[model samples]
Target: LWLPGMGAAYATAAPADPVPWRAILASWTASHVAHAVDAAAERLQADGKRAHSSQRLTQARLRQTLQRAESARTVRERRSGERQRLLAAHAAWREETHQP
Candidate 1:
């Protein structure tokens, strides 16, 4: 006789929703803020000489560098996530279409 708990498990349904943009933006901003702090520290160590506009330029440069890096990273992550979702959808579609 077949055991009650030995049957095949049912496939779980996918969620009917998309990624939240606001959440993504918040994450991107928070990551950049952290990077900015690191940039400031690096600038302080690299230059012992201080000019008239040294502090202002350093802050500006740090913010710019952090912004660019964060933007690129965010884009890459979003694209990677999109690719994963597309692959999953394709697989599910194939399975569903071929089922009896």
Candidate 2:
């Protein structure tokens, strides 16, 4: 028999507990999902920084290539002009020799 505020009456337990296990599990899943999203965001930021660095390096390489090509073109032009001058001088010498 139970009495009010007595030892046996105070120890009475619920016939069926209303524990929300499903809600607790959902909360756990949401926490893990948030962590995963944060990790993905960090990885994406790192990849973006790396991509930007690579793009800058590519631009620098392209500029170096263009400068080298221009230098080569200038050298070729100078050499061609010198060759034409030499050919003209040779022709003039041949003409003077044949004129007696």
Question: lDDT tens digits, residues 1-100, model 1?
Answer: 2222222211121234253444444455566677899999888866645653698888999999999999999999999999999999988998989943
TM-score of each: 0.44, 0.67
In candidate 2, position 15 carries an lDDT of 35
Model 1 poorest ten-residue lDDT run: 5-14
Q: How would you encode candidate 2's per-residue C-alpha lDDT over 26-94 as one tens digit per residue?
A: 555566678899999999999999999999999999999999999999999999999999988988988
- Which pairs clash (backbone N, Cα, C closer than 3 Å) in model 2? none
Candidate number achieving the greatest TM-score relative to the actual structure: 2
Off by over 4 Å in 2: 1-17, 96-100
Error (Å) of candidate 2 at residue 15 is 16
lDDT of 2 at 86: 99
- In model 1, the runs with Cα more than 4 Å from the true position are 1-50
Clashes of each: 0, 0
